[model samples]
Target: MISNSDISKVIAGVKGQINEQDTSLIVAHLPLLEERLQYLAKSFPSETLHAIAIKTNPHPQMLKHLVGLGYGLEAASIEEVNMAMAAGCAPSKIVFDSPVKTRSEIDCVSGLTDMLVNVNSIGELNRFPSEATCTIGIRVNPQVHTGAPEMFDVSRNESKFGVAISSKQEIINAALAHPVSALHMHSGSQMKDLEVQRGALEALKALADEINATSSGKIHTLDIGGGLPSEPLSDRTRMAEYGAIVHEVFADSQYKLVTEFGQWVHAEAGFALSRIEYVLDESRVFIHLGADFFMRDAYTKARPFALEVWNDTGEFVQGEKSSFDIAGPLCFAGDYLAHGAMLPATTAEGNWLSINGTGANTYALWSRHCSRTVPKCIAFDGVHSSIWSERTTINY
Candidate 1:
């Protein structure tokens, strides 16, 4: 039910001031972020820890905003853990779920009273002395594939994410042996099927039951990790239905539930702006640091940002359209925004391309392949906005 009219207005306003020093930037619509969080809050049970996955869009200002909203933090790295702490996340509100945790990292967080640590591997568990005080949890692979890309699919049989539950006995023994009271399962991100998530949970449920029968204590928590789609313009009724389905599926579960959603909450709230350098031809249009801005999209075509064209004057461009390969300002031939984008034929340098659906993974997953400066991050609140982070960033 959320619209981008406010965001559109902000972008249009920015167009009028293209002469400003930082014209090409991304805006995180604060209102949209709050709206999405509120919607999810209404959808899920109040007690559920709606943990924001730190890796999704770890803009520090966003983290501080989330903390103010009383949302929990699901950190995947030590830096993220520190970011969460810096943003005022209580130790109890943080969940550590990194795939590779070093000895020093483990040692540092071991004493935090209520922080949940989802141990990644059996080998890592072996290194943890029984005396470690943090709440112990084990990441379980349900071994239920969701047909996502191999790189993002963590439940695959050979995934490096967690202990693969090839059999019920395997995960049960691992959980009991490791002194784990919590079970975490992340089937995949941007999953095509909610049913797959339910199936994974069911698989974990059986394992939990096995542990309860064989061990002295019951599983205390269920960390259903991220993968729900967070598109702002998506059908709200259908999304509500999806939320209802999730509630219905887990209504009878005994343990306290936790959901980690990085993209679903933030993806639609963000946008990227790029100044057109020049159009090479009808087939090629070059923009600044092509691969540098959207490394994942330009390289692997994982989440190519949707585009809307506006003139340097900030007016929307509409006319006869032509397919243009949007190229980045990189030396590589493959640094293109889109291979066959149908754009206005009148596109030229100084015109701005407002890239949409960039609130989630676009900047968070970027790589400094060409040593380009990280685009400044802006936050919009109504008609007014401010630069949230202009942290100096570049690579030699």
Candidate 2:
């Protein structure tokens, strides 16, 4: 069994090998990622299909590991589809699930392997190429929003994710009329409620039954698109719970039960390492190191709960435990990552702080805001670590 001391040693050893000037660094815990995938695989051993959503981090090593474990890719874009292919994932092992697709993107994906196209609208269904023999999936909107309102507001009618449950029959009828093959549903993003997810599965199973009754060809696949919660929040429902839910919902169906879990698979396996550059005053600490890149990285805004910060130095100085704001090196006022966050009393500059929820290549979401260079990423197999990505420098 690996103890905390062992993990700490591995972290220290990896940190020693990297350049200190590289402010933003993401480290992937490969062993942990593999372990979670293996656990999921075992839980749903009867499942014929398990696809990893490619949007989370898309670290090549992570994708390679998933492919090695006999998992498929659930890609939402052409780039992700290409990445999966480049990583040795065959077309048959990929599901192209972009509900809102451009004509050109559809043109590019057409005739590419045995891909599953997830259609969100009747217009998209009408646009599907007649010559393509791909399995077609209709993404049903559960009309139940499950994540942070700011991040994925699916409860409101304004949200444009999938076709509503009220319109599921029409969608299935259209697919059957077109002679397409599968059914799909995605309640919302960052889904933490098992009940909501289960409800979606129930709705999907009903849709599948309806399709099977109407169409001569069987509804072969039932894809539960990626939205599983991760990190500090997913504790509400264990991965095993999710597996059991899937099993119960599709108990007698012959349909291949497929789930696209990206965040839950890779979130815990990554750590964002940042160093304290300087402290402004006793009242405010300004240890500017790396940028988290995406505005969505703030868990409080994305998941409805604030993330707890950990100081690696183990220094506990006493001051007011009041809220403190954390900001990146960017120039805009919106550059703040965390605001009104509680920190240690004696948090000082030059102390290393590592955010536990982020993963390697997490900074890939960073744009050239304020012309800041992108941070580097490193992969660690809990023992053997290597620089997978280099830190970018400002170039004219």
Candidate 3:
């Protein structure tokens, strides 16, 4: 977790002073993003291509930086594909992993170097040309439950994510029919438990073996889709163990490995700071609308951030604490950021809170139900701040 102290330090270091009254913005720490890339590099095989999930935080600058760091792009949409290309990421290095692909979208990427396309269902395979030029694969629902939130878990029996592995013959038939060279499975939970991950992969690997046997070594890449838990809250040691589990699973298989990690790489490097709007009571505090900025936090209503309050004068507020209900500026009744969050007794209007550990799935999940434009992001190179958006207008 990037501590409040860390965020405060960065906010303080901005070239110009930040106005607490207008502090609803995100600070992306490039150094932290770089460090995470380095750490993930160590955890995977040297040959593994770490494709950063673009839908997690599709900042063009971040995309370009990751490409420079030898990372690839995992795109879930054609627009994301264009973003990756604009970032100078090689077509081969990008993995098209969308579950819902229109026929035109399938026809567009007919030929690309070393690219992997993991179609969602057996039916989706029909959209591809018979001689399409990229490595194609089918998303296999391993059906290994991760006990994650129902929405996050795609391995459930009724999941609509992938071709049901339950139809054993159909899965085999798809591999024999399509121009596939890989087998991909995404249990789609940020489950950090090593044993649980291994169990899921074991199922996928078995299916891959079955496919490879039928295709005479056609399946050579195993794309274990990424859903590692968020940083700060996620256990790094557990991730290391999970890495070992992956290695152990394919010790004897001669297949190239691909990873598409999103949350673990970007979560720790981002945060949102909101200005205090009102103080309803002794303990009920309200800030700017946050569902339009940090929907993951709003959707789950979990206080995943480490709260730090700073007054309008940029003074860090510290004193005896009390239960503070930090509400959002939305019209809904359940827009509270923290239900009974503990905060400084001095916490009130004219004081801003810096929400930390929000790099991934935050702004990318912003909602505009109230016609709220997403706040501009300030990218920090550890010393200065600059708007990452192209123009000053909030164009949500």
List per-prediction Cα lDDT, in the order shown. Answer: 0.77, 0.67, 0.79
Global lDDT for candidate 1?
Answer: 0.77
Ranking by TM-score: 3, 1, 2
lDDT (tens digit, per residue) of candidate 2 on 306-365: 233334433323455756666667665555556666766556665555556564225545
Worst 10 residues of 1 by lDDT: 14-23
TM-scores of all candidate predictions against the true structure: 0.90, 0.84, 0.92
In candidate 1, which residue pairs clash?
Answer: 230-264, 290-328, 290-329
**Residues 1-396, model 3: lDDT tens digits:** 665555666656652644433447777888788888888877777788889999899888889889998899999998998899999999889999887888888888867757788888888888888779988888888877665667788888898888777886898888898787888887775774557778878877888888777678778898998877765433456567667787789888778889999988998888777877777768788887567666766777464578888865456899998898888888887777887778888787666688877788877777876876566678877766777762233464
Candidate 3 TM-score to native = 0.92
TM-score of model 2 vs. true structure: 0.84
Task: Write the candidate numbers in order of decreasing lDDT.
Answer: 3, 1, 2
Best by lDDT: 3
Write model 1 residue lDDT over 181-240, tens digit each, in one string.
Answer: 888888887677767666777777767777887786558788878777665544464346
Candidate 3 segments whose C-alpha is farther than 4 A from its true place: 15-21, 233-236, 312-314, 390-396
